[model samples]
Target chain A: MSSQSVVFKPEISKPLLQEVMDRSGQNVLACYQCRRCAAGCPVGDETGVTPDRLIRMILLGEKNEAFNNLLVWKCVACYTCGTRCPNNIQTARINEILKQMSKEAHIEPLNPKVAAFHNAFLTSASHFGRVNELEFMSLYEIQNTRSELKRGGGWRAIVDKIKDRAKLGISMMKKKRLHFKLDKIKGLSEIKRLYAKAREKSVDR
Target chain B: MEIAYYPGCSLHASSELYDIQSRMVFRRMGVELKEIEDWNCCGATSAGKTDDFLAIALPARNLGIADASGLAEIVIPCSSCYSRMIVSQKKLADDPGLKNTINAELIKKAEGKIKISSILEVLVSKANSGEIAEKSIKNLEGIKPACYYGCLLTRFPCDVEIPDSVENPQGMEIVCKIIGAQPIDWSYKTDCCGASAVINDTDTSLLLMSRILHDAVARGANCFVTTCPMCQLNMDAYQEQVGEKYGIQKRLPVYFITELLGIAMGFSPNEMQLDRHFIDPFGLLTELKLI
Candidate 1:
């Protein structure tokens, strides 16, 4: 372990700790830095900020650094970290709050593709009141293509990606899993209203 | 025994095989699965991550419908859907403010009375009670399966409250034993399959799935079984891709737990939609003379 000392500044630590506690309903102070969460985390190797490190960062008042980590975006919400936490800290739930806050604060996500996919899913749900897998996949691909083009992957990368998706699509079709028709639940208007209410609440927050 | 059924999006579409097999297995065992009418999406992890209220509200709507239908318990076949619905119900019950807001918005009160259960939970209980054992028409002694729970089915012990250990659940193992199949002991049972990231981050999902598949095969599992359509989809459909990426010729057939149970309960391979699997299980079934 590096012997770098963290300066405990109450000025920064107090409010950040309170905000996290309020939003997550988890006490950062309860975490004794046990690293149990990290040990059980399935994507610990793939994440920029491991679960233990994230807790430490939050406790240390490294608010921006903790919130902006790619791990928050990449977390599959598998609850492995939460389940393994000896302190019952619910690290996965905390990560979820951090992700929501990150979105609200407009922190540039390290993984835009995942964010895009989420937006596509929400859009599909808002429209149909249920997820149309084919529609969601198409919307996700379109958003992914735009992101790839913006990242300068150019036309060839986009073409290759579409080709791959097309192959998968065909395979799913062959299995009769991919339906061409759009599916909507009966209470579309009720779902739309709920979305509107959620948006209002989100804006209020 | 009649139980409210919530098929969610995947069961209605991509994982229709799971729905068919589960219904068939339950019907054979004298259980009536009444599909919840007009149930909406459970919002899953995607919506849950985007907005907490929407996530809860989406499933809350389904709970309200189930509650109105007078079903005390709702059996969800998909693990992801079960997790969302259960978590949402708990959240709604715990927070009256959130529940009131959702109730006001949806024009339905989410009373949180309906207990959400995974199909595995329901089936395992039946197995433990000897209902399934008595119903098994064929022995599965030839098949060795690694029962993969993935994440959602038994994650977060406080929330899910599954019958077995959350970290190393044996609900499926119990079911396998009841049906006469040997369930292999293996790690990575509760490991994440990277879920929706399968679409957004294919490489990461492939790597994760490869690890799970490799672990199962290393433990001498001839086939893999799961309850979640998302997990089944990733392991079954993308097994080839992961094998190609890792340069391993691991071709373990993935089956929904219900499919295996249905087979043992005298349902034919065609009824179980075994051919619908991307990695067709028929060859393995033939090899084991299970067909």
Candidate 2:
């Protein structure tokens, strides 16, 4: 790794760091440039931003760099870096906060599929009080197709993907790994209420 | 002999083999798994990544239901579910004020403590007591498994520790030993499989999975077994893709820890749907004379 000299902007650091800390409850300021987290992160190499670097960006108030990075979207949330950190600074939690901030700021996600998958998971969970795998996958595929079409992706390619995935889905069903039933938990309204409260809290933030 | 069961969505859907084997093994041991009525998803990594309340409240609802039903303990077979449940529980234990605020916001009550156990933890616990050994009927001597703990089972959220060693866990191996299967030591046991990415960003998932599968093969493991549905999905279903993407040709069958335990309890492979995996495990079992 190479080091670069850059101006530290404390003026820009306050709001981002303050909100991130308040949101995640992680001590981002406690990071001492110990690259232990960097050494352990599985995607740091490919993403070009490690956990330590992400924390440093917040500490230095590089809002642009921190918000618009691949690591934020690509992080597996494996808790490996958190497990290795001496200060217990979990980058996964920090990434989650940045995701909320980015979405609020209207920054288009660098990875749409991951974003769509998370959205599908939440939507399925909120509706059914649990994830209906059949419903979730369908929702995810619709978003995926919409994004593909938006990117000027080929209809032929999209159809080909659908055909391939359909084969796999059918095979899994045959093996009894999948079901064709629509199901929900008994306390459905309670789950819906929780979702409503969470949405209101996020809007307030 | 009776306890709560939280068969998370993956268990109820994609990883039915794990769910079925868990029930079969536990039933043979005389431990009844009563699923908490109307249990909800714990939101896995998705909820926490977007909404803090969804992450906390979802798992808390199930924990609250278990407590209300007078069940003090629950078994979660999925590693992701276990992590979410235990992480939420730890938060309540660590901060009473925050717990009170969360409890008040929950439409359902979440005021009581609940113990969560991974199926690996349950299997190892039973193995430690020689119960698994006593129930064994098959001669499964030569079957060797690379005991993959994946990311969450051993290395839980920090400060929330399970009894197994974090860096190098032996809980699965402990169960394997009693059932006459050989469990191999391998690197990457606790490494991330880039699990969720296997859905959205498959190239990265393939790379991470190949690393784990290759390491297990190099370390002389004939097969792989884990309790995590997410990990099993990557390790088993994607073995062909992993091989094609990484130039690793070895195809090792992966099973849930409960599958091996069930076979030792004299359950047929067909009964456990062991052949349903992309990399069918029956060939390895047959070669080892385990069938």
Candidate 3:
């Protein structure tokens, strides 16, 4: 028994692990402490929490830690972890579930810009059956700037952001990459129904 | 034959060059691309992260359109849209209950009979048939390209079948080879470019992209060829920023796979809209005397 590392199974609360498993459809229990996911994660060093460690948090019923990690916000859904995992456990899906859980749990998002951009994207997708790139980016800019202001970011920061984005936008426009003409989808009512259905179903959860 | 084409949001504007070059090149290869009638966004990484049902329902709506149109197959250029479409296509096909639940809100009901193809897969098949090789007016023997697949081109849900090796993709290489371009086999072929976070988390995205660029450039790749609009934009539009952060002086041009194929097919830089890229995709071509 002394020859191998031992796992001290702390008294585990069933809710956190069960909820994540249910929502994400990933078998977090299948993780055997192999750090294959850790080595492959592009942002693991930056996030300070690798896929294996995050799974350990869930299995250990560390609800707050599971929902609040930077991995939950910064994961780009690269699928590298799932590709390399021996058990095929996808942390990207788990991160998505945790992001929603954090929002519902009233834990402030560690990365508000991601949240704001997501909201802007959905709002644009809902407004018109398709995403108007011009509308969505403008929406993201407004919400992101406001959030930064709320966080006490100085006007200087906002000005710098505007200058940076303006330069980027102008370059894109010069190349005819910016769509000045809006192209909305024809099935507008159908898209609205889908959004309404999603909201109604999500509330029931 | 007429093939259904789904451009998604990025293709309409930000990746217009890809759209233009694609139309031009496919026409040259004797294939007609008919745009899908008023397709919606696939929700991409944003929609799925925002709502699971929208992720499926959004793409399903388009699949429904294609299937209903009797276009047995549809081709997508963007990797993000292709992955979303194929993954959702597989999920809705396998689970009847989930399909029924999502279908109730749709104007067009998805029958789950349509096949989805990425533009890279389409080109590779054409290259194999000798159609693409026949159109090559100039031998692209001089340029060396790093075929960057990024994330979603070949990686999907575990159950879905991918056309190429997920770890080491050769679809771009296969097509480039047909046109006489030597494609570099690099380590960062499947690396994630921090695509969705390119804007919200700019620093992290740049760091990830820097690693990818570093490896490709180290391997002596002159330019990057990708099928994903997001990957191309991140590397092409923001390589200057990536250079500043990583202190790398070398600026490698990024081009769409279709654009590179267009170059070999005797289309000029202006015809291919090579100037649309921030890094000047034509610079390496002109320097190498390929064009």
Candidate 4:
């Protein structure tokens, strides 16, 4: 915590705040720095970024600082914070919008695996019109392995990961939760078009 | 009562027991579930992070299909799916421009605005009206269950409108009482079980799950009754993992709320697929003489 007396700048760009409010339908300005959001957050203790702090950063126009924080990715999207907010700020929704903005700005998340999992999930859904759990896990593992190797962890890290998943994977397979074949929902073309249109619109934004 | 059923991806695959027990319980209650044709994934927590439009569009597509089915209401078994569907409906209702764009993009019209409901909501209403109590054949007086709501079921007060108090929900408790089981009060009832984090960040996810389990155990809960499949999977399948990590020997079995309801309704263990859980619940059922 900074002990220095805080100075408020008179002329601050509020584009990020405006965009967040506009996109999330949350009243970013209504937040009064009440720590109720942080108090109710389930993962608040695990991360350095609290819901109040994130809202404060946004209010202070620290868009880059707030967007770069790993807390954005760490949020479980549980909405505990939102439900507890006195002003109904919807802090979880703000975090989500920030996450999307971070991706749009091509900012690599501090937690790569979370982003990787999201990418793998969307990829699977877009292709099959539904999630194929087996395929999704495989793609996520492949991405993780590639990134690990690039970071110079080599085959040891890959082997370790496989070993970690081996027991659970076998159990899931035995229970018939995991499958060998890909399951595709009908009307793949419609889903493909939706994905294409979303991509096009996101790019336009 | 007849309603459109949206099982989502998890129900069709990983969480098939939830689907089975849900159908069985509802069937016994004379509620007919018409499965939504060509329903896709709700995108869970992934789509919103990857793409905003797809997040809303995926669930909206299902809502459109459900509306077209002539059903005025849709019953969603998974809390996550319920949240996504409700949120999507609210988003479309709030933003006509976005809804228009999505409709144009998908080339399908969303008509008649179908209502989305969670399985808990449906069951609790029946229990409140004495419908469940009338149907329940087996008494579960010996079972002490900690009803777990997780996050999605009662969060976002403005959007996901659960009938019970969001902070201290009683939907599951109502059903528990109707079936003659004791519902214990415990903290972390609405806490996140770290959902997908169970796959990506095992250590943190285990820690969250362990805390919830420890709390329920401290409150003298014999087992967990949950509405969400993700919560069941994390708490039930990972019970052994958490026990090993925390050096605790207590293995509390977790069951879907519908599974327990089925048991009370005189459905056999085989009918509910109770044997398929990672932690075998047979011992617990036997102790209560419910099998």
Candidate 5:
């Protein structure tokens, strides 16, 4: 892949590089350019870089390429590559650390379709403190710019929504008879307390 | 012995069977579940994916709340919640700055200190499997179940040491065996079934679930058992979806490990909420003559 394909600049500072090396056991540089990690990865073909390429970029301090590649994000952390690695290198953990770094880097827009699930997940958690599958799906549909039914006169989307609504309605009805007792959660107050503490620390920093 | 329990959001709502069966089984085993009151979501995958603090705060808040409740170890049943709680606890525990920041919130919230542990750990380390086996009134006998860990159970193996090897977890299998069910060995035990992603994106979720189910069925597993509510929900709720989407006509039943244990312990279907499953588990239990 061309270096120009990356939309953002690299943040390969010495400290970041040191951190990666520290977590990866200095084995990131030990990769002899073997394609085994790439070959062993089931989803390698779908991402831009193979597991080997991802590690190489990190080893070379190409933080931008290492962080932005779909290879790091798409890895289900199945540990297949890590388990199969001849060097006993933990590729899955390394991939996750890189993904974390990528998030912190504030990369630009991903595919609009891909963003649907992420948005739904965040909206659900931000509001309910838990995932609401029905709400998440509905919100995703709306964000996709697709109505309850797909455009072009197809009724599939409408049917899906109708079915979804019925199920959701039934679920809510059943839930009403049960006592949720949300008040019993002891950590809510403490978490709020912790949040305030965190804010104060940030301000102090 | 009394212990702290974190019944994740699903257990209180969609996957109520897990909560019901867990409570019953724990009671039967003479274990006390001191529920952590007013606990929030664990942020699962969403909070972390969107914003680090959002995800961190979700689990961190719950952990702090559990801590304030004065529990030494929080026993979580849901794999997603379990992983997030333990990981977030470790993160906060290791980072003094983060802990100090959260502790300020703890001071305001009036909750005490807490540590996180999965129910697997609690049952294995504290409950004593020998006692559980001795308490078993009935055996699972001929039922062959696929022991599924999904993705979240042991993602960060360092934080927790579940009974089996993280790479090849056998805790549930041991529990299943003690109850008389045969644990089918398969490569997909730790594989990802795409978790909550299935509800939002059918394509990805189906593909992943199909792979898992296909592997289990191919290996002659009569039913699939798991420790996570989300995994159970996905596997059970989307059976028809996966079949229709993939053109497979067979029915694959999924059960929470607790439900099977509850059944083996001579609990009735009503006690385990077996009637509420999307894919009926009674047929399998009846076929095994455990009903």
Candidate 6:
């Protein structure tokens, strides 16, 4: 997932902080490390740090820590913490922000599998404009397996993946029932233009 | 209007209960759905991950058939399918070159025409609150349900924000309240359950689901409701797995919003496909005196 490295040294400006707070709410600055956001976050226990802590780190301009921490990667983007934050913080959105920052900074991915999946997700959207889960999962597994092999332990797992291919194929084949024609949508051209614009923006950023 | 319905792969397999309950719920709600004569796959997450053209083509092919068969909209019960179809539809509607490529592929697969829509949007629009109000047999009281949107339902339509608040939506809550249930304030309404990955990746799914269950229990919620079959399957079937792994034994029955509505309307467990659920929704109904 890392095409480049992003280095941050807590040089956050006031306007950026205000913009996040405005989109989310002003109470985000009121978080006092109570960890309520983490306590209630659905993915918090699975993550290294709580959602509240992640947000605090960001608010305090701990840009490097916020972007590089594994906590930022573990978020499922479920929006649980965002809905429950007493500080009215959009923890999920903040997580999205961190993810984007990580992408920009090219931080080492905590879970290369997820990063592969994320890349696959974007690539699929950019190309076809919709995700085909079966293809996506297969590609995700392949990419993840390749990443694992690069780290020197994925070869054994490859056999298991191959052994399970039949079952996987069965599951993948199940996707055939809900197909639809794409030519009839009233807004096809605009959507493609927007997608191209987005891809360019992300690449530029 | 009779429209072709694609229940997706999951509805026929992993979470057939959603398919069953949705059929019953839709029937009661007075909406007619006819299955497509010969439908193909939508090429779900895997397709989307690997090949963009395949992903769009998968869902697009299905819509083409529905359209050719003379149905403007194909109502889908599975959240993944709904999201895929909507995203694909929007993409096709927005991109001419992609639409041409997708349409050409679809014509070879099917001889029909169709549009795509999620059951959630169908409930909100096609079979509206007016119809629901007219056919009301029971109203939920003292049962504060938190309408869980999961992720697929609201992520698209990036403009106009069709459902409710992007973060915490109340559309399902409003639907429940309209049918007479008091929607509660819960923290994990939009949280993911580590869904389809739970099969391949256990630890993460367990950890995530445990946190969600813990949050709901802490909020004093008696039950959980959702639109996605994967979310329902993971949340319900994996509850045991999660508890076993974490040593935290907490069980909150998860129901398809349709099943809850079925019961509220005095429908039996059989009618709502309660017997098919990993957790017996009937047990919760009995506890709530809803059955």
Candidate 2, residue B9: Cα displacement in angstroms equals 0.8
Pairs clashing in candidate 2?
A: none
Model 3's CAPRI class?
Answer: medium
How do all models score by TM-score?
0.96, 0.96, 0.96, 0.96, 0.79, 0.63
Better of 4 and 6 by TM-score: 4
- Candidate 6's residue-wise lDDT over B1-291, tens digit each? 566788765665556567777787777766677876445456555444323445566666667656666767788877677766776777677677767755654443332345566777777663354876666677677666556777667653222235557677767876777777777788767667777446445577787787777777778777788888878877876677687787766577787888767776678876655665555556666766777
Worst ten-residue run, lDDT, model 1 chain B?
Answer: B155-164
| Model 2 CAPRI quality | medium
The positional error of residue B150 in candidate 4, measured at the CA in angstroms, is: 0.5
* Best candidate according to lDDT: 3
Q: What is the C-alpha local distance difference test score of each model?
A: 0.84, 0.84, 0.86, 0.84, 0.67, 0.63
How does model 3 do on interface RMSD, in angstroms? 1.3
DockQ (C-alpha) of model 1? 0.69
Q: Candidate 1 on A1-205: residue-level lDDT in tens?
A: 7697779888887877788889878877988888888888777888857888988888878988888786787788888887878788888888788888888888866788888888899899888888899889889988888877788888987888889989999998898888667778788888988888988987997
RMSD of 2: 2.1
TM-score for chain A in each prediction:
0.92, 0.92, 0.92, 0.92, 0.56, 0.72
CAPRI-wise, candidate 5 is acceptable
Give every collision pair in model 1.
Answer: none
Regions of model 5 farther than 4 Å from truth: A1-42, A45-48, A57-108, A128-139, A146-205, B108-115, B125-129, B157-163
Query: Using alpha carbons, what is the TM-score of model 2?
Result: 0.96
Worst 10 residues of 5 chain A by lDDT: A175-184
lDDT for B186 (candidate 1): 90
